[model samples]
Target: MATKRFAPTPTPSLLSSFTTRPCCLNTSLRALLPATRPFSSTPTPQNWLTPKRGESSKSRKGKPHVATGGSVRGTTLVWGDYGLRLRSHDRRISAHQLKVADETIRKRLRGTKYRLYHRVNANIGVYTSGNDQRMGKGKGSFDYWACRVPVSRILFELKGDVHEQVVRDAMRLAGNKLPGLYEFVRKGDPPVMGITKVGLVGNSEEFLRRPRVPVEAPSLPHTAQRIPGTTPV
Candidate 1:
């Protein structure tokens, strides 16, 4: 019966300052590490465009139709001097696309004295499920956030001491990142309701209220008209 005895290894100069006990080593390590501030579980506010907490996150994909009454809200610049207005059909724009467009404008107008305004909020949450999964249980988890923009609705506006050309160029670059056509609009411009612009002197209510007169079809000449149930000789 023989017993083997191993030599105790020498501790490095780094560990010479603290005892080799497991408890002492742990305490020593904690003391050597830098103190970290506790981070809040709540997410930092992204922007005003992001929906607030406790608000309804899931929203139905509603049509971007303007009511017949014609309210001119978001049709013209409210705070900014210049704006980018949608000129095409209504559609839902995702938050990512909007962010890219925003970045594009900001990048183009960097160092300029301009305050950009966002007319829309990405509060609507879109949900989707796996393509192979069978439908029936429930709507899948949220996929992305989006905002509905109707025809002639302003998306972004700029206000500040910036030049008109610079503002126009920035907006033009931004428009390329987003879907649908967009036009530059200025302050005091006529408000647009749907595809029609409400003139300064025109009443939106009256304009929408006007009835359409249907055009009558032109009558065909005798030589061109076909006889009913008659064979041509």
Candidate 2:
């Protein structure tokens, strides 16, 4: 002898009174929402980022400090009227990050006459191993391309007939997409050496020469010499 099972009665949702048709509610919501450009589903162009064929797939973590040991070169605006310069510590900026920032600037400046300059390229390849993997298998596999950007280095430069305010706004928005602190710079601004600006308010010659000076050994007697297994005196 088995008991009979009964079907449960359905209940209407509270929202059913206000929105009789689900499609109509969806349409109304869409109408109230702002339209936005869809994110690109296509792969990034290899020409814009990927390292050239035959290039090393992995690289050392190189410093942004130039051979001169100062952040002089690549820190000033050269071709563009305005630029975005890093103001904090150096870091490896990935190709994807760069593309996002570039797209942001271009989107904001759409319909404007302007030329954007990429001061740095994502030529360095970064590699990583799988999680929970044992060591000694190798340096892992190629993960992404990146460029080492030193502090005070200009990442992007823009020049055109666009108004200063508009360009500034565009750059500000773009900077937010990038890592680290950034400062808006203009043409003719003083070049930066490290965190300090060269030739600003002080003797230009002295400021320029400070980082260029080579280290010299102190004058010593003729008897003074490098001891065995030690550095030179």
Candidate 2 TM-score versus the reference: 0.66
Q: In angstroms, give how far residue 89 of model 2 lies from its true place.
A: 1.4
- Model 2 agreement with the true structure over 37-83: per-residue lDDT tens digits: 67888986556577657464458767765435543788888899999
Can you give the TM-score per candidate against the true fold?
Answer: 0.67, 0.66
Candidate 1 segments exceeding 4 Å error: 1-46, 54-57, 200-205, 211-233
Q: Write the per-residue lDDT of candidate 1 for residues 1-233, one digit (tens) a residue.
A: 89999999977554676787899788778776779967799987457456766345456778777656666777888898999999888678999999999999999888888888888878777888898878795777888878888788889989998899988998999999999988999999988766777764565657666777799999999997879998867
Q: Clash number for every model?
A: 0, 0
Clashes of 2: 0
Local error of candidate 2 at residue 128 (angstroms) = 0.5
